[model samples]
Target chain A: MSEPNIYQPFLMRIDKITEEAPLVKTFKLVFVNDEEGKKFQFKAGQFGEYSVFGEGECTLCIASPPTRPGYIECTFRQAGRVTGALAGKEEGEIIGFRGPYGNTFPLEQWQGKNLLFIAGGIALPPLRCVIWNALDLRDRFKEITVIYGARSVADLVYKQELEEWAKRGDLKILTTVDPGGETPDWKGEIGFVPAVLEKADPICENTVALVCGPPIMIKLTLPVLAKLGFSPENTFTTLENRMKCGIGKCGHCMVGKYFVCKDGPVFTLAQLNQLPPEY
Target chain B: MIIEKKLLKQDSVEKLFAKLKADGRRILAPKAQGDEIFFEQVASASEMAKDYIQTTLSPKGAVFPRVEALFRYQMEGKDVKIENNSEPQPTVIFGLRPCDAASFAILNSVFSWDYQDSQFKSRLAQTAAITVSCSRADEYCFCTSVGGSPGDTKGSDILLTRIGSGDYLAEILTEKGKAMVTLAPELFAEAPSEDKEKYLAKVPVKFDLKKLTEKLPEAFNNNELWMEQSLRCLGCGACAFVCPACVCFDIQDESKRESGVRLRCWDSCGFSLFTAHTSGHNPRPVQSQRWRQRVMHKFSYFNDRQKYLGCVGCGRCSRKCPADMNLLEHLKAIAEAR
Candidate 1:
């Protein structure tokens, strides 16, 4: 064959396994081959097709930031066949990953602007890549703020990382839980993501907001952002569509004329408005 | 692309088949299977179906199989051993329609558009098409409406049109066809004064393709129209299964504890599971939306992205649809929709 197989994945060994939540785990995977590891590169917000050799592949974001190299991390909730198999894997186990697919967040455009990140529940992983990216290059941006919420305090992923971000002086992090989901010793806000975002009321001028969450959270949060004077172009989000070949060939990820794998997983609110609600 | 046409005596077809076999190529041709015709391996030209207007399934499987093993794997002590699927056997599609022949490029545009699927590429490289022009067409045939005709040669390495006097007018289209001619130099003769079109089937245009493509984007919001059109749809996927240009597939692995093979099998957009997320939230939840997607992808989305229409106007889909969901009628409805 003149060309190599596109579906063939790079073999990665699970370096570390962190139990982020009840059934969610973050796997820090390193390339099995040192040469492959040094050559590998990916940006924040791009996703991969994680494979459990016996099971099929699942589309998940590179939850880890690009600032750190040598390995990539993926945070997934044990929801499906592939994820269940992935969660069952122990550290040092081998897995397959065909990756860095789809588009990335244009962080260069957000430089010198306030970066506001709003995330809900399991959707936090995609945004966490950008949140850390912005934090790593803190001097490039003006103010960095994170308002992350979930169904409950127990359900929030990256618990240790959240505490670390909260301790950092360069950024402000506000964690929240749904009204009835808070514990007696809970220290964060008690409300849904939209309500919590509205209560904070951050300034919208020269600011770019990245929001990723459940459909309802997104639907409710968009209007709140608009109310706070955030324009459609200033707000960015990523879309996750069912994919087989994550490289635009498989017709599953098409949203109208655009392939979510090609045109974007990242799009402005204005771009989303032009597309049909297929995703 | 330049075309070199020649006339072959009626007796020369069987001789050419012998030559192809001698060239170490497996010939795939349409054969009768009960009532339906499907592409099957044949030893000689005489075994090929003579009266079929079109096969029940496309000859696309010659290049892209229904289920192809992408890789074979075995677990070692702590490492995994991977092996790419071996090269596909050289194949020659003996007698496919021009419409089905045209589907190869559309499929090629997809598999090679971004990341080259070498599995598909290798198969295509090893395959050559010898298309037989239609002498008769049925109600479902719409080759002309989609910029094709019974005599149109798009994807064939060699196009054979039956002229008067029971002879064949062969158009050597590619290097593969030239190579075949070299194998049996005596069979191909000087072109006869026979126009291939005179003997070809006349499939009148049913709907204006340009109008249909333009109207489809605007009509995408009309879910009620899709519902009405696809009311009888069972989502059986026979249409997509038989379609020449439907390239959607699902990757799966079947293992026997120690070893396994990863296969990419044919999948359809009409299936509910095609776009269902693991979270149980499906993007295309209803049948109407799926039907709409099938139409829109072929008419609008594919045209915009791939620079090629996804439908080949082969009519296998309309003929194989168990629901009797006539694609032509629906397309006409979409074209005429306000």
Candidate 2:
């Protein structure tokens, strides 16, 4: 292969776009070159720098699971300049993507153990990758519990996937909306994810908890997990930082000594405790 | 291995410039401009500033420019065309101080860490550095504290030390230096064995690097100290802009209706926007936190990750800081903290 140009992005066409929630959309991207698609490989919890041609790039996790190949999916809210441009784009439009960067969740280590997924609001996308990855390899895991929450009933992403997961008899899935967020007809739980998790009271033994959410949610839930007898070593969460150049060189995504884009985006609670809380 | 040494008459320095220019190499030399010295393209030796402690900016711009276009793209109907900028031309930077020269190596660790920055790589490959040893020291100079010296030859292709009023001892350290020598062989003569240190500057070590390294990590949570120290900081980013080792950058796209170019510009950790997330959350939310990041990144974090000190003890940041925030003073305070 020729020398790799670090900043040059691979062209990916948006095959489909889903309005997962208000202001949040999921883009199903396929590589413009079929050969590139075949070679592209990413594990759960890894992120990529996605760009609009005339706009800039932003870091987002590969929302789609690796078990399903041929295309990658990313869910982003219309927050900033790049995401606004990304939100404005239609299907069949070409955008730039570079990555499969950072370390992945140690899924093999969780084999034969129960898996608990805790996420909030737009943060579901990062955990969704790991959730589907474990579900696809169903035999390797025992009981799977998913606790997801959003600001309101309308704010939850992947509604179809939530319904499908709830219907599965093998897994226990609980969805929640914050207090005062539920509609009169809303049937799911009403409260925060951490509070709802405490009520569910899943067995902490032989289980790994994967949590992703807003920083506030993560800060609150981590303590609850400790109270519920989940070891810090077995609890993992991915960090989000403002980044340019998904590789390590750019230097903006650093949290303490660690480059969030390289050393992590994924870190266990045990690992996080050792690091400075700058993130 | 024995290194070759030669002498060049100070007056004949112009002849060396003539030869370098004739060979089609762009010569970047420190020149006196208004109140400060700046590294600018020079046509002749007389244009160079003869007396200056240090330039306003580091010579990093020669390799990693302030603004660089990665590629230009144009939309041709539904298809897009990309044209990468050409590689840099062979260039020579003359009169760079030893500390600034050493910074190139420190910066190399970051640029080539995981993703190779080809633009920076090509510029570094094509450029040759000629470092002049400091003959006088300033209060802000502390090269010795950070594993460097006034006459350190860590990153220079050629090391030049003034031996007398009109004579310089030239030690060619790299093949590029030897090639420059070959360009004008007659200008160089055999140097008599003499002590060159007599003419060099003496810079005192201000702080204990070993002690500071051990204490800096513990200082991360000392928010009150950081807040007190950074109270006067305006967050103008002057220190980072003038620093030789500060390598943070921002990438942007400039476009018209159908065409645009992706440009990378120098960024600073001192800026509040540096770590601001799109969701209106900032990891380093306060000036004190940002200040802590600068100190921790340089003295602790960078060493842990890159196996080298991010700072070269050039003291340019201290000199350029408008808030009078001195790195040496801060480091001393950090060392003295319980």
Candidate 3:
């Protein structure tokens, strides 16, 4: 058969749904066609356009790692029309998915080096795939540190995964909430992520830092990472822009000459420094 | 490769149009619509505008319409069934100027870039463009500045240059043009071997493209210049709608209960809502920033990707702009920026 049209989406059924946080849900989707499911492969940091049949499509990074096959997972918060419709969907419901688009994180370059993942709020989904991928291939890397923060303790996603990482003897996981966001029984750090990151002080020597968050969080976190002696070339982040066509035909998600949908959703800080700050 | 040249009498041009229509080809040509000339469906050659300098809108809509249904979908229990739209029919676009023809080549680069849009590709494959060499130009005409001319046949299937009062010099460019000739071989004759450049319009170079390319990146951080220049701009998006090379689009679904159709509609970066995120954060929060994006996308970003300027110097944006936000003036300002 001829190649399917670029716009036509593959039917995917939601096998499982987990309430990651307030207004946020993680969906485990399996391709309805077994042939398509066997043929699909994507690395960490690549995204897909998920559609809610009658609503519209939204771009989201595949939250599940490639090591786990048969199904792909995505985490999304109730934000707009499409996400709202997706929030209303139940298990066994089918949605449209098109992708595995854009560039992947350069994990091979960070082999044998310490890996530090820093994410804020709902932005953790983009980094979760990489975190698990590195953990799955544990012997290849030196040390793993995850510093994730959210607006409040209730807003933190992947709670079960966070507990599992915290219990692991080989990795260091630091979770935090914003100032005044902690309850009376809170055990994690209580401060802004950038400030807590400075206090945690993961050694910058031969370490790769992956950071993803809101624009303001990213803007403030980069300077702190620079101050902590993290090389801009080794520091990476993924940008989220409003997109229509995830394959770069639509011109909404451009940062300078780069299309976020094609050239990158993942970029090194050194590369981001060269681009215009429009994203 | 040597290009074959032929001649067609003005009276016999109507016969070629009749023959094309008889073959069930849709003829899209520049026709008068109230006060403005637009590229609309024409039945005969006489219905086409005879004295228009340029069409108000470019012929880009022939392949990429303003709004088109991508696919229709209906819910079947828990499953959704999608039906693709029918492929476009063969078409012939007559009376397009050389600048407008060149714009098609620029649009092709974006549409065929990472993801091949089947709707646009199918329509473009079946469409034949017949460009007419310009005999007159206005102050807004600056095709010569951007590596195009009044007689350029870069994206045309057939180029017609008026050689005399009742005759035209035809240069068949592609296989489609050759096929059109086979339809009415009796009307086309051997060219007379004369200078056709004398009859073409005179469009002067307004700015240095090399200098503009170099200075545009530096001007990206100069908010004062962009803000001052775009202070009078009203964000109506008319410029983007009229521009042939502006290919930004939005995908939306219109559903009624159990069934719906997804549509791809024309969108513009000049508008404030083009890049606004769902979380109430807008990257381009002001009109100046949006205007800067439009200028930089055409002058800088496109050159980086395709090694060609997105603007074909067609001047449709300037002509259709509600406010006097002239593209040539901004480009010249960028070229002359320190």
Candidate 4:
């Protein structure tokens, strides 16, 4: 009875909120307890269970980079009941958070390799953590290229960050929208994510690829990456199964023998190949 | 832990029950409701159900409630406050079968796997299991095939088996059991001369559990096998509800504007929505896949990860199944398959 609760969450204050897209918004959260804030740590691929008091908890990746400490950010669309509850809140309001769960992306192993980030729609938040981390430590890696796409120009999240990355001389950014999903003045390429990735074919040797997107985007992009000589081991992605506890218990998320909350939210394509297609 | 064997007179059971009740411990024993039996709190041993192989539902609700409050949350102006669930009362589950008793360990393995769950831990820690050995088993019983027997004292505080003289052959198996003796030591007599096995039920090993576990991973993609086995499956979730070793759950928030409690409720893999995402994507969409998950998770996944099998061979699912889906027959078929 004296043990600390695994279900109880830390009180987090919403310090800042950004309206990223039409329905997508990001909240920058800071721990209300100063001691708890100082002790909190998470890696790139890890996620958390964010609660909205009246509504239930939602499993969301810590969208902000671990390299930039002191605050954590989460971007979500007004999709479901929990997410709708989350989106209703404004800056300075409080929410409940408990996490930093799951395995981290092996950033130390990919230190000297070129980083290729391919993301689609809302899935970009999960990959953006590692993308920003790799960019912040730009001197440690080679050429970094990002190919991001959405259903339409209005659907693309992190617009400001995409603009900032495009202006950065060190990085290569390619933005795309689906066929016929472009606005009249849309400057980005008009195509699906896989086509944009195939068009902007970067060399695959000594490169590490991180892909996160809808199921269809992943299904189509994997062959494209494989054709470009990126082996299964060099390709990585984070998986999201419907989870409740966001821990090993509750038993909502599993991809074969592995507990996605414990064994991974992040897995190499080779590792995923070893598992059954349960997620 | 070493177990000390002793004899408990049939009349002494009532005395022990009284002593436990007087000691401020809540005693939950099987009570017959119409034809079905359930675990409920009783003041006297006479209220205990007679001649029941297993309860309609496993005594799992004793250690893990059907619905439990994980935490309480309150909205205070712009801030939200969190409250940890309070500790449970000291509880003793009496007259559970050995199969039901053994399931507590499987539940323990899951709750304490990597991140220890305090709510489950506290509930389990405060609860002690006292099991009665089964002297009679129906066709549904298969505990022997799953590495357990009617007289198995694996997960019991005290294990009691009725001998030739109708007296209980008591195995004081744990400190918790000894504590009950400490409350009233005079009630326990000298050890009985009768063999405890003579009084227990004979449950045959219908299938090879080791072979079944080994065959599960190989049978993962055997769509024909799963589809055939699950053709009659209603996806009713009755199997999980009656299962002692099934620990899957769902977390939800129940609120009335300002104050709310986060509840952990029972869930089953067989339910389609159990693995369905909000984006209209379902990984295990079909009943056959869900059936395969139930089989694979219990036999293959739990053994590989937790070092404990997720089924105790209680066969409550088969007994209570509206579809008359015999799990023993299915398991035997899977094990004997080429």
Q: Judge candidate 3 at residue A38 and give its lDDT.
A: 98
lDDT over C-alpha atoms for residue B295 of model 2: 92
Tens digits of per-residue lDDT for model 2 on B80-172?
Answer: 777887868789999999999988877889989878888888888899998899998798988898899998888998899998765899988
| DockQ sort, best first | 4, 1, 3, 2
User: How well does chain A score by TM in each candidate?
Assistant: 0.99, 0.98, 0.98, 0.98
CAPRI-style grade of the A/B interface in model 3: medium
The positional error of residue A229 in candidate 1, measured at the CA in angstroms, is 0.4
Assess every candidate by TM-score. Answer: 0.98, 0.97, 0.97, 0.99
| Model 1 chain A worst lDDT window (10 residues) | A1-10
List model 1 lDDT by residue over A1-279, tens digit each.
667888888999999999998999999999999998999999888999999887878999999899989999999999999999999999999999998898999998777899999999999999998988888888999989999999988999999999999999998888999989999999999999899899999999999999999999999999999999999999999998999888988788989888998888999999999999999
Q: What TM-score applies to chain A of candidate 1?
A: 0.99
* lDDT of candidate 1 over B198-314, digit per residue (tens): 899999999999889988878998878999998999988889999999999899988888688888999999999988998899999999999999999998988988899999888
lDDT (Cα) of model 1: 0.90
Best candidate according to DockQ: 4
lDDT of 2 at B178: 91
lDDT of 3 by residue, B280-321 (tens): 888899999999999999888899997778888888888877
Pairs in clash, predicted candidate 4: none
Candidate 4's DockQ: 0.84
Q: Is candidate 3 or candidate 4 better by TM-score?
A: 4
Comparing 3 and 4 on lDDT, the stronger one:
4
Best by lDDT: 4
True contacts kept of each: 0.70, 0.60, 0.68, 0.83
What is the lDDT of every predicted structure here?
A: 0.90, 0.90, 0.90, 0.92
